[model samples]
Target: MTAMASVISKITAKNQVTVPKQVRQALGLKEHDQLRWIAKDDGSIEVKKANNNDFWGVVMEQQRRYGSINTPEPAWGPDVGGEVID
Candidate 1:
């Protein structure tokens, strides 16, 4: 079996961490891509790319289930006018 190289990253004050370039390249990750973190029973965390279609499917299903409830109308009416400032 081939051995894998290890990379390290530090988390910022805002609790944001950057993925190492090697790991990103290995995973074929790109900008604006989503990741899911899984916490294992052994207290280890695993990260994987999130499936966009599954995410959107859940969103659409929730919308279909509760789309109309407690929705607010637009605050401004068509007759309301405002001057544009340069």
Candidate 2:
């Protein structure tokens, strides 16, 4: 279920606007927070709270730069060894 919050704000000249209180609280946003936006083919817009410090985007970039780490399992050291035969 989704909780509906009512917020009212106006768009500035450069399409910049402040997020209202109820909306911000609902989204758990704070000052100097970051938001990710994607414009869909349709006029309708879908928005969701982005991960902390843009982790998703950074992970993708890291993968592209430093390939994937899918190496085979490494051998364990002296498994099933008898109690130190000192």
Candidate 3:
């Protein structure tokens, strides 16, 4: 695997870390974006950008899984707030 450049960040007293500018730029991060943290068996950790109910992302995933062209209904369940499209 190719080596990626690393940046250092200090954890705040409240256990928060400011994602460095370079990392944020490379990851295309934005304010209010969520991150998913993964822990590997080798005792190392990884951070990945988490999707925030991205519409196109859900569409593509459904197409790949169901092989259907139709937009998949959101599984927001029976009592959710979104309106019915039809």
Name the best candidate (by lDDT).
Answer: 3
**Candidate 3, TM-score vs. the true structure?**
0.56
Which of 2 and 3 is ahead in TM-score?
3
* Local accuracy of candidate 2 as per-residue lDDT tens digits, 9-31: 89999999887777777778888
User: Against the true structure, what is each candidate's TM-score?
Assistant: 0.61, 0.51, 0.56
RMSD (Cα, Å) for all candidates, in order, is 8.3, 7.9, 10.7
Question: What is the TM-score ranking, best to worst?
Answer: 1, 3, 2
Least accurate 10 contiguous residues by lDDT in model 1? 68-77
lDDT (C-alpha, whole model) for all candidates = 0.80, 0.75, 0.83
CA lDDT, candidate 3, residue 45: 92
Instruction: Name the better of 1 and 3 by TM-score.
Output: 1
10 residues in a row with least lDDT, candidate 2: 44-53
lDDT of 3: 0.83
Error of 1 at 69 (Å): 7.3
Q: Which regions in candidate 2 have their CA more than 4 angstroms from the true location?
A: 54-56, 59-86
Q: Which residue pairs in candidate 3 have backbone atoms (N, alpha carbon, C) closer than 3 angstroms, thus clashing?
A: none
